[model samples]
Target: MQAEAGNRSGLTLSVPMDLRQLRYFVAVAEELHFGRAAKRLSITQPPLSFNIRQLEASLGMELLRRTTREVALTEAGKVIYREALKLLALARDAEEQARRAANGEAGAVHIGFVGSSFLTRLASDIRGFAAARPEVEVVLYELSSYEQIDALQRGQIDIGIVHPRVMPSGIASRVMHREAFACLLPETHTLARQEAIDLQQLRHDDFVLFPRDFSPGYYDKILSLCLEAGFTPHIRHKVRNMLTIATLVSHEFGVSLVPASLGKVRLPNLVCRPIAHAANPSDLRGIWRQDEAQPAVLALLECLAASPA
Candidate 1:
């Protein structure tokens, strides 16, 4: 092989030196005895000596001072031995990382989720996934159901936690949890003190709700539930975040219909009550593109399936 002289170190190196030669050189350099080094490498002395000579020729330098009685490393041999150790270690690490990534035990996954999911078991599910797959990094993004659908289609997120509904083209969904709807009312509201309130009782009440564009399916579902009781809500304000809707209701600006699990949000002056009439349950679903086959995404899906949410 042709060798190139390095400008900085005045060392010549073959363009592609065989790693086996370097290994043999390191063995002999450390042992300082050809017989002992060959035994350590499970080889005979002749082949070991040949490999060391080849390595020295490839680097265009004398790597060893050999005598009938003993062997010792030259200055060039010491430098090459230290560098070979590092190269071998790096090669081993690279192979291990590749294997772990192929098996879905390492790498990063970008996840999108609607805000309300945080109030449910989603947090615990994520925590469990992180604990089980310490090498796999989880990146979180808070997005609306509609936003998640678009992000999934664009390949911006690997997975999404959203309210279950008809998914857009190329996307598939798995239901994670089913939750009932509840009314969020101001503490000073007349019906707030009641154990449970009928949806019809709030017929004339002004409503605070999430913006229709953010999640049209969920927004319309809430409206339909109100209509089933008596009257269509008088929408006074629309916000993009569920928690903010609760904050608005706390100030008595209006009431909102949110997933029952959001009742866990303990805002002062805010109260949540179950609707007396039977209502459609809200579904939390995990969504991904039908064509997605990323190992990280698959591992996260497995985690979600194993955990209750």
Candidate 2:
């Protein structure tokens, strides 16, 4: 302690403590053992003891009751220990807030989508989102509608573009577009001459279809349409994705049912014809974990909703 002399009187003055000393003192106070506190701080026992002594001397108070048999905190030490924890937490929070502001939209976002997402209008939607929010870094992963739902709940993905048939129980969805079913045929096929062909007529012919597990809704939709036409689909070959199915149809593997978006693809030996039996087309929707007040995700949803079907 230092004595400050004034014209009126003399008063004892104590040094103002720094954060490092408070941290060291708190660690030792909590552990109640020099060796353990040193281990916790990844420092040697000698340095830990020296730091604690310096902290006590600076505070002008004995913070810990030390003995050969035991170590414990004095009453004053307990008060400082509790306050130090809160101070450390607040300090960390402030640092994080500053970093977040400096980095702008620096957090990572996980994006999940249907298999044909990259090939369809979803590509344009993604490009538009990237243009608008270039600072938001996104990690894109291709997933089925069901898998997308699971990922969202598990906090695996932040956004999803999926088919409408999949129920999004805890998530929010925005209708991006509906991809109408189209008939894929060989250029020389009779149905290619017509503007559209009845889905029923093709039920008798061998067809290429997506695997049931990969796209249960899409697979079942086709099967149900065939059944409504008074026949079971003659699914001769099963493929994993739209491109593969389109390739097989181009090689005259069989006639296939596909989304109108597939028409964008130019296959030398194949033509895409609209299905006359389609009453209401399948919907392509954007799914996201619901946020009552997330401006960024809301902006993305608005973009998707305004896009063409």
- Shift of residue 280 alpha carbon in model 1, Å: 2.3
Which prediction has the highest lDDT against the true structure? 1
Candidate 1: segments with Cα more than 4 A from true spot: 1-9, 12-14, 42-50, 103-106, 127-137, 227-234, 277-279
Q: Report, for every candidate in turn, its global Cα lDDT versus the true structure.
A: 0.85, 0.75
Candidate with best TM-score:
1
**Residue 38, model 1, lDDT:** 94
21-126 per-residue lDDT for model 1 (tens digits): 8788888888899898999999999999898888787677788998888898877777777777877777789889999888887998999999998888778888
Query: For model 2, how does the per-residue alpha-carbon lDDT over 35-82 read when each residue is reduced to its tens digit?
Result: 888888888888778877886787677778999988898765666577
Compared with the true structure, the alpha-carbon lDDT of candidate 2 equals 0.75
Error of 2 at 33 (Å): 55
The TM-scores of all predictions, comma-separated, are: 0.83, 0.62
